[model samples]
Target chain A: MKKPDTAKQMTIARLLLQGNEACVKGALAAGCRFYAGYPITPASEIMEAMARDLPRAGGSFIQMEDEIASLGAVLGASLTGAKSMTATSGPGFSLMQEHIGYACMAEIPCVIVDVMRGGPSTGLPTQGAQGDVMQARWGTHGDHPIIVLAPSSVYDFYELTIQAFNLSERYRTPVIMLADEAVAHVRESIVLPEAGKVAIEDRAGPTVPPEWYIPYADPGSGIPPMPRFGDGYRYNVTGLTHDVRGYPTTRKDEVEPLISRLFSKISKDIDRLQWFDSYYTEDALVTVIAYGSVARAGLQAVKEARIKGMKAGLVKLKVLWPFMRQTIDAVMGNSSRILVPEMNMGQLSREVKRVNRGNCEVMTLNKYDGTLITPLEILRKLEEIYPC
Target chain B: MLETAHPIHKYLRSSKKFPHIWCAGCGSGIFMNALIRAIDRSGLAKDDIVLVSGIGCSSRLPIYVDFNTVHTTHGRALTFATGIKLANPALKVITIMGDGDAVSIGGNHFIHAARRNVEIASFIINNQIYGMTGGQCSPTTPHGVKTVSSPYGNAENNFDICALAEAAGASFVGRSTVYHTPLLDRLIDKALDKKGFSMVEVISQCVTHGSRWMGLNSPVDMMKWLKEHSLTVEKAKGLGETERKDKIIIGIMADLDRPTYNEEYDRFTR
Candidate 1:
């Protein structure tokens, strides 16, 4: 049966969709026309939703042989100028690491939604953990820049999916949507954006003639305009470090320019990529840092601490990668102590400590038992940090 | 503009991309020449056709062709080809892979594409060894053949490339060797014309690496050996096991009527 135009059929301006369902809706609204994925826990709902809804929206969905091919297919679709995505967790993410690296190297625009599960290799399939935070950045080999975004609630899940597509298209690289099991499986009410209101972006195609089109050249911006394969540009594409003409080259000097462009394209625009929510950190003595589901608890702890007439606050990152020093500076400006409560044993905490530069006491309250660190635990830690 | 009228020169980017990485006397060059002829013979628009190849000497075919091409990671060409086909069914996609690339590291994607009957032609150049990686023993390396990876002679059984594809439910499966250049081109053109998943296995040679090690050192010796070892399907049929043993049956292994993936998918979506 065909899924009706859900946006038009809605009774209210809101949708009570699960985080995973919201991800699909957001992708649909954001102009994703191709999705290829292999089923994995805490992430399979995306595949299910796409399987049911993508066709109705004139999109394509395929269950690939494995996670590697899932992303390979997604990249393939992206090459044809079709917005593409895939979702996986744990081992599947591990399998996709190399292909993700390929996407970064080739500068193919696509989205990857990774619903975090307890890992290190299938440590816990059904449980939540922000353990993949580091993997999202450095899982793939080599030194390539990446854009990663985390959605804490069902609403952010929907919002971030749209943002993920927009960023991917604009930047001409794969964007990772980082959501833990707590966020992806959570059910919440969200006032969905009006139909045709969500902003969408498309990758620039070659304006030059077929012979003049260089696949990897600087198209004014550091990023090159990528033409769809059948659009007659007929330019060569490779995953190896290449010259602006897109032919493989091993010349050391040429490698410098190719890699530098890959990094500078993202780093130079770090501010635009930087996104986070700052709550009461202006004058607070104690600051909490969290993301994904942990941020939800961190938010509660901030409110509870404020209720007790204490100077406490939080900084939750919506965009994780292209980690900005400005974000850390803003979060730590007035706070004497920084508390990082995470599902993993401190993936983001380590980065926070490094960026904090020993300016203040940065503490990591970590959980690794495939469970969410509750707000009560966060509050208790805060109390211990400052008695009475 | 008149130069582009030549069918072979139209698809083959020999002018700008010459001195290919293939070794002197390597059959991969022959197979690529035949493939271009096949593309020209298929009569598809150049813009609507794409060549995707994984890492290997055989996979380097796309680098020498002017069509929309993708030189992907090793063994991943099939998935990339499938991606291109699925994304735009209006476009025609083809993959160039080596023995190791198509059935070894890329075994899963190969069989699945056949099983799913995805609309794409897979032209596997079975050079019997990892030509680029220095004559290493590959999945298609014949048993008892000595190579770097199989110094004491390989114990692994070789895959019958066409048989495996036919068993996997491919709609079109054909086999020919570099010696049969015209016949090989015809097979590729026929496979490309088929609706669903199709495969054309070209028995290529790695003259630099595999030839000396496998005792076919010279071009003449290799050509002679290829001609002797592989027999026509019609000639080999009904022969005794002793007569047919070690003989590579080269002909149409399978051709069946089947609905393509895009067709089924479009119907379901509608």
Candidate 2:
């Protein structure tokens, strides 16, 4: 196949695209061929782009009836061996939890893009909030591990989507790209990578014969080779905790091994899974921890604080799950205090404190009014504590 | 000779699991038997077919079948079947669901799958009531019928599943009752041969739930009631609107050809 030139293509060059559009481009660039989604606010553009582009790109696009069916189709399409994805906001994401758990337990590879909006219920349909940070980690019933990537900028929206698909395919679990309204709607100049320039990861397929292939058989790497349906390999997959053959079983011996692998697969590979960008961390007195849209405000605050001659730094988390405790601890170990700002009521702050273990004083700046936390607001909180 | 000649009965036993999960005189078992007979006659390898079902008494049919089967959550059987079919378009995927399972909780999946024209045989056992959940009014329950949830009588008009399937773009749509065993069997045979979305809405009788709640006492009585009340689509066409009012139409409602979702998807991917 001739590699298409992407670097020289700058038709509009400055054509306005939302963060959601960047996500679509990223998914398409990452080899997403199947998109199943139900339209929801602040996230619908991702579906719209897929609908428009998938057909032309020789891919499939389905507008499912609701969020549950959307995720259901996505999981179904992934099993067919297509790189599948679905985008939704809060309520839709909530409905997708059960299937998300199924994806986790069954080890299905798929991408779920959640454009965070204000919620508990239909709290703010068109607004932005980061309240689902914890839910993304533990919303589904049962013990399972997941990878969540938070993208702060429109550029990260493109990059994180590719990472999300790669992580999902590599780990054989659902990976979430958590974006908020600010990030989702924000338009910025982003240089699109030529098609072959970016790395695309496909799920590992079964190398053994049908009889030798156990769908969930531990390859000792914690992830088994996933065989797509219609490959003449007969294997059963169930949502219930099951044995290696994918048959449902309640045996204690079988259950422990399966659950342990589910955790270890990601935990052991945490280095490749953790993604963060630290700014001016050397000799910093205070570290500000944040993710998604709030990280933008935190970065700006750090920049402003630096002008005032304060030794404040930013620890922006791109990979929010697997906690990245080692990196977080390493970054904050020298700092006397850390300021964790988020849209929710101190969810990630609690995580910071838990990981810090009283080594540093942790302070939280929470705003739940469906608006972006301003850089000035974070700077004021930092000044109140550090008093520079 | 004919009694001992059926190939399905040879592979299947008449023992305890023989009579199956359906109540004696329930049409579901008769339809199930027809499905087995069609499969046996199709000459497809048993290992090549996978039967999937959602939550319902009818959904339990796949569990009893010796072939590879999946008993999934209510209404999501088609989604799982789609997964299996897409992974291997060569695998003959069949999904069995009930009225509430296919149309109520799973209605969105049903219409979308049909619209996509996914290549799978979808067998919907429309027993009128939520049989497993103790006779709640279902999407197909007759208007003004009183059930546990509709003590004041169901005010909602039921979905015409055949119409819904046809409108949603299913390549094949057929309706039959347990009374017409031969026709149901023939339809199943055709559906198995058809390459796109083939839906067979078997107007089954939920004797335990519908009979007790609707004041129809026994399975035989319910079967008799279905025979008396149901009208063939052709027969209904000849009758006036008033005469055909509240009548159930049984026959192949619509049949057309459309590219199956998987086939189109495969062409794209390939």
Candidate 3:
């Protein structure tokens, strides 16, 4: 077993790792004991790494028949109180949305790693595209409070996967580590955290006895303490519209509260749940809203635009869903236009438009040829939006 | 009334959740009752048994019982059950599925799970048609059966589920109809006790839809049909080939001793 390097006394050295490899190392560090996956391009490396490493750390892995079964197993392991996860891209990710809804409605805390690939039907298996940005938020039908975290760099890939697990546990919701193919396959040297330096928070256990405990009871925090299966509670968990006691119900009064709670749980805590970084938008005339790999180019364009005396700034989204509206408000509030560059035809820009609410022009620099948006393209778009 | 209700109520959820959604003549309730009695008979700790079911009348068994249950998506109960068993080997995981769930949309998972021989019990409610979706022809719908999806006749041949499970390497396999309550309950008990990927294919009757279309509309008729059509394996062995062609051979089809996946996993990780 690898010793915890995050301990203050331990000296940690930098390791060169692909984003996929870093994700496995981070998940293991977060106490993930079960991994269920189905192989798909660009994301399959994560499965391979997890299969090799998770078993060594006393964890288990299963290559399920399909993505639906993969997430199903992940949720089952989670019900037994194991930190579990699965990795997929494109078609496989689409297969998982049904159970992702189950995880949300059942309030199962597990991580889903979507290593974004080009799609609309296996369009480009090896290519990176942020087409799933909107899908991550609204793909699973019905009103659901969802969390999607995007990582732009190798270090962010490592750190965000851990963050995904922590947020999922804390909120009792499935967290999406939305890394693009670029992030998953890109290799970079990063300073690995020493063991114990990274904080690990497991899901809270029920304090009350089985008799008094209601499985879905929310004492206004909108988060209920979960009892692991076989811990003597004998409570129930299902996909049905259930009551506080976890029994099926058809009452409108009961249905509204359960459905409302599902959305309100995260919407109420947007401050703690939302995370992003903004640059120079306070004084700029235009801000480019970007996330995932496109955000890397957005940051570069912002710097280059600034050197050439164009008041160009960037808001790189680290947390995509339950989107940081206030963050965009801070960045685009002072600007005349917000330039949204992405591999998809403006998926996230639509959300920016919804949240920005005509406060500024939400123009998009769209690319869908199975390639990353170059810094030059973003810079050119920024110049066109607000010529210096 | 309260005293008498307590015995059955102890195995079920609150009264408000009852008058269960099951139709009047369905045999799924019988299967559910047998499952509950078998658990009670085995004296297994209630908290240690997790019931995971897929969508359908059969999958709704977990909705009535008071165990730690999850009524999952259509056709994926075994996948979830596999996870629960692998996560905590001490817990007894059981998956409740319909014929459509186990043999059609979920066939890959059904076969893979049996092949792995994971220590989880699966109960397949074979009602010969898709009961949930308005009596459509299912993968296990009998040959030449007429229904909404197959109004003329079912072109597909039914899957002999016990043979499929045994072929897929399930360590224990059994088949019994709801009419044979004692034997069906015993089948469930032995399957649960086998310590591997054990399965009991219960020949449940869906009276409202498929069975009604097949002319077995009432509960009495469905039960009688099941009893008359199915022969005990002992009796089946004596019959001539032509005489046994239409009978459902019933009994523990396979029971063998082999190392279970749970113990093997522990050893490999250790």
Candidate 4:
């Protein structure tokens, strides 16, 4: 394993950068060569940065007509063996769901950055909200598994963008970087790493001859090497369920394993697939579970509660899909009470409750008015539960 | 009878499975033949070309040719083709669509792609009706044309595709018809050689759909109508706007220098 040079160069410093800007830098460092997106607020900076930097790095950047085309272009680029991505917000993300499912069904490796704003439909374009947690998991129709990662800070926006790419390439699936407006617009100091110092993952290419290659046939790693077009590999890939040869298959025998592997590939490899940050859970009777920008408030409230002589801990989820039930259950299992805060009406909280199975009371603090969850409100909830 | 010589025929096999899905005498086959000829003449290897299409009868052109092809969703051929082009700019990307596929459902993508001037050759087979969907009035269906959707007559005015292409900022825009075989062959050849967004709108005959609905029984009759209605751009220039308004203008409408979307995009990254 090549050690990241910057891993040893520890200078705990900061640089002011927007969350979207950080995402662009992280994408650049991760060897992303193509970006196709339409400009939508809170996420427009990502497009601007990519439009400026992609060409300089000998990559491609395009402002497509709409979010559908943006993601469609990214998927098309991914098939040609390019590290491609696109960014959008709520309404745009809604338009991209169909193609997103296509990427999932095709097992194409690409990234979609959703800098979420409040919505059922263009509710709040400038404000932050985590209402898309359920949408990120179930936006696309059908029973397909997805990888969704949420970043809490500007630095994580950069760091997680790289991880999103790596995970997509590793799993051969569309990995979503789900960010809300707060993180997208937030300006913070992020240290730039020297070149050749960040970990990157490249998609696996066919090791066998083109004739011997089955594009969708897994090679023990649960990911089949992709052979690009114009590489003398003639294969058919459809949005329909397909067999190893990439041809659409409807046989009972073929359908079972095809769908089963889609779930198992990510589920069985949960260790490398899941990520979260936990705090102060050693002897706490009360815990808080949150993600994205809301988790920052959750962490602060936990700290405040600890100072007020309340034993409160935090479970900040990074990976939001395949639910990470075991990790979540383990962290919140012994707690007397758990607070699940989000920008929506307890979407993630419902998942927490479903997995908790009555072992601990799962309470929800949801705000859907397109505002970030305030640390004070969370503290007030904590005080009510374990009154000072 | 004049013999049609298309170079792409050399790469094609005349077999049972290869008979093609186009109706017997449909002009789309002629355009497809011309495209294959252009591809063969370009000297680019067959393996290096990627043909993308949206859902429509004309969009089926890619299925007959031996190349990397994607028959994607309706009106999304440009988006998919754009993706393919960006991924491997080395691979020659060509997209084919019909009137509705390119102008109606796919209009947003079409204009934006042209505005960006992505390095792609978009061939819009303008048969004036949605042939695949049973002769519904299309974006290019002429006003007063009777069809399934337009029972009495098509109330909407048609879009002049070449004019639209020129207005949308395509570096190259040309028009031809199945009747103007030699000119179409030359136009397609030139369009392929051009480096930016090249769009060739081929006026075609949907005899089985449009003609049957409009009371024309045979493909020959439809072909005859196309020949009589089509005029060269030079001929149309001499006529008054009202006189030649509805005439199909056949020739290259615009060809100018502009950096392609990929070229401009690459500049930003560097």
Candidate 5:
């Protein structure tokens, strides 16, 4: 196993951990004190791990009636100054859209882990599929800003879960860790990061006194410090368009600014939010762009393509949303063709095609048959894209 | 000036522009008044109280109150309150939901929250009709009542909010009407102090929708109707089933000491 950079100052044990188990460990490491979720396949282990570990780590866990209530509970706990999260599959994630929009509008910091399984509705319970990519972005109504991170491996799941919390806390918005069934259930050897070795971020609290605290005042940062419910700062938080004080409002000026600020706060800091890895992209005619478990296959296919004397590279995305346009543009500028291999009907590939602007031939390799995209399948697609 | 001098005024947010949106003779204001009076009487620190509400005319009560308040989505206030109660366990969490918000769209959360028996005071103001969306028949709209959604003499049966709470395992359940302000205040007080899920179903009048649609012309007419229709739980015990028909039983429906969700969670976790 490769030694992780976060593992330092102590002898770390290389333990075999599943992707869902890694997520629970990462959440605990990041000071997550509250978790509320329902059981859904591929995601049930995440909720189970949280239920077992959260109590031991001085946090709270609740199995809500449904995904809607689960997310609602997480949002409530977040406002009480607790780092909170929930996990679900496709159908449950669909139910959570209502509060996901609420979280975006209210600017409550929380995390949601969508362990993908096949679905329009309960399509494949135990099997894997990546059908919720667009749902994660546009599931919640309105043009709300969201951060979605896609983890490629079990170790990546552990690290990105922590990153998801950091980003959510720093931005005061919801972060989604979109993992497919393959990576979520896969067991792999991963070096555990030492406690306090990895940097953990806590949401900024009101520096001003209770009376002086403006719950939504952004002093130019577009992000404001939040106060807990019992922090003596008696404030109102509503889903409606509101002013700096957090009261419901319909005035054009107040409504316009609140909406604009929510987007600007994250979009402006796109540089910090975007995370990905490019392999052999320095010199390649064809590059494969993918995320989650498919990205792992993409990496292996790229190596096989190189051995076959075909110039194939891979761009594995860690942060999916605010879609790394500049990086994709850079790949487009260099590569003659782009191949996006995913588990859905070209969800991420559609974004790549939009960004491509016909600059390069953007091809897609999609499989939604509740199976992982194999390296051989991607290699075959690469061979078709690049004549070797 | 007189309104500002009122004791409950101190609990109202000075910044929120309010000549509240409730129509003239609306019982929502009456329930809001009783709620604030009860909170004030309890002497819980204002900072230690969190009032959460779902979307409705009744849900707007939290915005006017000077406490840590959250006006959440439709029918999801109890879920949010459950989180807050478990997170702090010290903050007095209260939820105010309308009839439609509580028993219809949010019915699943309502039953589950009660079943979990989280330490939350849920005040469901059953105005019978959806007042905010203009007089649609709610889950609590009486059977055969004519409203916008059920204009041709309704076919659906109404939910008994208190009985539902009792069945769902809420530790404390009570019913009161706007006409019974003292009883409402007392019930609100008991709910706030209860250890587990405490539910108070307030049979309130919505002058604009519920009352006008029901042929009750004014708030006074509705209050008189409530007074005439409701019977104390103690008084109903002596009456036969036929005699109690159409009577809205008011007063404490259930009060049993049970282990709260938070207390039980803390018992093992801590």
Candidate 6:
């Protein structure tokens, strides 16, 4: 096959796109050929875009009966060698938690988009909150491993969504893109990445023939090569803790290694998984740490603090799960105080304190009234911490 | 002379861990026997068949079958089958669910799958009790029957599985008891060839838990009860409604030509 000129496709055009719209574009670019979702506020735009565009690109789109079935379909399609995804919000996310655990236990590669909205049960459908950070970590039952990514802008939404698929496929696990309503609905101008410039990852397929293949054999990579259905592998996939052959087993010898491998596969690669963007933290006394839309406010707050001759910097986390501890410790080493601001009752702030190392005074600014934290509020916390 | 093995043995997984979990005389084993025979008769390639199931004793059937199998979460097998069928329309997808797994927790998915008329063969093994989680009353449990959950008596009315499937717009619907194994095999064989959603409600026995509650002492007694209560659809058509009360109508209920979801989707997209 002749290689098409990627340079012509790289003719960059700046266009205004909503974060959710950008997410759909990224999914399609990442070879996501299957999407099954039920409409939920703020996240509905992502589903709508997929429904309109997936079929034209020779992909499939389905609107499931509810969120549970939506995630079920996504997992099912993923097993058939398709990059599949589903988009939903808080209430819907809660419904999908069971299947999320199934995907984790079964080691299926799929992406889930949860647009954060005010919750505890439909608290603020139209408004955004960062309340689901902890839920994203522990929503599914058991100590199974998961990867979550957050985006701060429309551009980040596009890039991180593609990254989410890559991580899930490479790791053979579920990856969640946890975007808040603010980021999902916000429109911004971004120059689309050139076709060849963006990297896409497909799930590794089995190298051996069907007779010799063990469906869950780790083979030293901490991940087994996956086989698609109808590929003559005829292997079984179950949610049960199974042996390498994929039959349900309760033996301690089999269960222990299976669960450990699930965690070790990601923990061994924690350095690459802990993605963040730090700004002006070289010689700062007070550092602001945040993610999603709150990070945008943190950046603005640090900028104002810098202008006022205060040593302040920002660390915006792009990957939220496998919790960015090493990065937080590095930030804490240089800064005497850290202000963790979020649109929830201090979910991520708890993580910051857990890894504080007692060198810095870790403080939190939590707003749970279904609104984003403003830069001024963060600045006030910084002033209080510095006592200037 | 070499004696040939049973035809069904060829379809059993080489790695199948058996001394199967089902209690002695559980109807799921009977259904599995009939299913393999039916598949053997149909002559479909094992590689092209995908078997999906939800959580229950019946759902465990997929692990023993030599095909692409997925044992999914409770009450979500149809959704998974829907995805698999759409992702590869050429693959024959079949979902095996139990009473609670199908009509109770997975009721919404069940009806929608039928309504979409997706090309899938869904079999609901209605033993009328939650066998795996102990003998709890299920959605198809007879009203006023005693169960662990319904110690006094079942307060809820039972669902008519065949009627529900037909009402939900399934292209093919059938009902047969484990006693009628040959008919069950034939019905399942026909369902496999259906181009859209097809379902067979198997009124099988749950001798361990369900029989204890129903006052049936043994598997033979339960089989006798099924034989006495079930009437072929043609036989029941001549009987009055009063006479047909509580009778399990057996045989094909509906078969119609409809535009399947996968076919319609492919036509428009291609």
Largest DockQ belongs to which candidate? 5
TM-score of each: 0.96, 0.84, 0.95, 0.88, 0.97, 0.97
**Residue pairs in clash, model 4:** A15-A189, A15-A190, A53-B269, A54-B269, A55-B269, A55-B270, A56-B268, A56-B269, A56-B270, A57-B269
State each model's CA lDDT, in order. Answer: 0.87, 0.84, 0.88, 0.85, 0.91, 0.92
lDDT tens digits by residue: candidate 3, B63-125: 788788989988899999988988888898999999999989899999999988998889999
TM accuracy, model 1: 0.96
Model 3 chain A scores worst on lDDT over the 10 consecutive residues at A3-12
When 1 and 2 are scored with TM-score, the better candidate is 1
Give, for candidate 1 chain B, the lowest lDDT window spanning 10 residues: B9-18
Q: How accurate is candidate 2 locally (lDDT)?
A: 0.84
State which candidate, 2 or 5, has the greater DockQ: 5
Candidate 6: pairs in clash: none
A best-first ranking of the candidates according to their DockQ comes to: 5, 6, 3, 1, 4, 2
At residue B74, candidate 1 shows an lDDT of: 80
Q: List the residue pairs that clash in candidate 5.
A: none
Per-residue lDDT of model 5, residues A267-348, tens digit only: 8988776588999998889999999998999999999989998989999999889899988999999998999988989898
Model 1 lDDT at residue A347? 86
lDDT per residue (tens digit) for residues A89-194 in model 4? 9899999998888888878899999988888897888888888889999999999999999999998999999999998998889999999888888899878776
Considering TM-score, where higher is better, how would the candidates rank from best to worst? 6, 5, 1, 3, 4, 2
Residue pairs clashing in model 3 are: A4-A195, A5-A194, A5-A195, A6-A194, A6-A195, A6-A197, A7-A195
- lDDT of candidate 2 over A1-388, digit per residue (tens): 9876667554424446789999998998888888888889989999999988987876678776788877877877787688899999999999999889989987889999999999889999888999888999999988889899999999899999998999899999999988999999999987776568788888899898876666788898999998766566656666768788766577899999999999999999987766899997887889898999889999899999989888899999998887988888887687888999999988888898898777788999999998889999999888888834
Q: Identify the runs in model 6 with alpha carbons over 4 angstroms from their true place.
A: A1-10, B1-4
Compose the digit string of candidate 5's lDDT tens values, residues B1-270: 345667786898888877777888888889988988888889999999999999999899999989999999999999999999988998999999998999899999999999989999999998888898988898887888788888797899889999899999999999999999999989999999999999999998988887756687888888999999999999999999999999999999999999999888889777
Tens-digit lDDT string for candidate 6 (A1-388):
9997788646766789999999999999899999999999979999999999999988899999999999999988888888999999999999999999999999999999999999889889999999899999999999988899999999999999999999999999999999999999999999988787898998889999999999988889899999899999999999999999999999999999999999999999998877999999999888998999999999999999899889999999998998989999899899988888999988999999998779889888989898788999988888888735
> Which stretches of model 1 miss by more than 4 angstroms?
A1-11, B1-6, B14-18
> Candidate 4, residue B3: CA error in Å?
20
